[model samples]
Target: MRILILGGTGEASALVRGLAGSGHAVTLSLAGRTAAPKPEAVPTRIGGFGGPEGLARYLTENGVDRLVDATHPFAARISRNAAEAAAMAGVPLLAIRRPPWERQAADAWREVGSVPEAVAALGEAPLRAFLTVGRQELAAFAAAPQ
Candidate 1:
């Protein structure tokens, strides 16, 4: 079976390692955001697939038997594209989903579902915040003069 894994995180790397010598041809795909990504056990492809349609094209062209979305939890766009592309190309998709991180009593975290909500939650104070949002959503938080 030909498996194309959308990978970037440690779990994705671990998955690829676990599937080694499993009689499956696996290819890992990265977003090329990092200048130097750690090496993998299987063949690796770095870059985007344009969008859902482009991903579908790649899936069909490459004769991918299965697609595994092992991207970061924050990579919503990539996961969405993978789902749509899998449907479009008639390929099976396996998503490695991780449960939302449970906040410990000592953790100071405010979870917001949307960018606007995140901005609102930040309030108008000029305080520092450790944000884990995507690049597209970064601009929303730029309103903070801090």
Candidate 2:
């Protein structure tokens, strides 16, 4: 089976290494955020496939049979695109969704649907809130001033 993995997180790298020499053709796709990503056991393709349409085109053109989404949990856009593309191209999709962080006794973690929603959930409070979401998402919090 021809497999295409949308990867960036460590899990993806480890999974790629595990699939080494498995006989089935495999390719890992990275977003090229970093100049040098860790070497993978299988062939790696850097950069985006435009969006869902472009990704669908790539899947169809490359004869990809399976699409695995091994991206970071914060990569909501690509994950959605992967599902859309997989559906459009009629390829099977296997998303490796990481389980959400388990809540602790003192944990005050509140999950919001989107960044904007998170900011709104702050309720105009000028409080110090640790944003451990993602690096790129930090800029959106500036509006909250919390």
**What overall lDDT goes with each candidate model?**
0.91, 0.90
When summed lDDT is taken over every stretch of 10 residues in candidate 2, the lowest stretch is 123-132
TM-score of every candidate:
0.79, 0.81
Deviation in Å, model 2, residue 29 alpha carbon = 0.2
Among these predicted structures, which one has the highest TM-score? 2
Q: Write the residue-wise lDDT of candidate 1 on 35-124 in tens digits.
A: 999999899999999999999999999999999999988898999999999999999999999887777888799888888898889887
Clashing pairs in 1: none
lDDT of 2 by residue, 99-119 (tens): 876778987876888888888
Q: For candidate 2, what is the lDDT?
A: 0.90
Q: Give candidate 1's error at residue 123 in angstroms.
A: 6.0
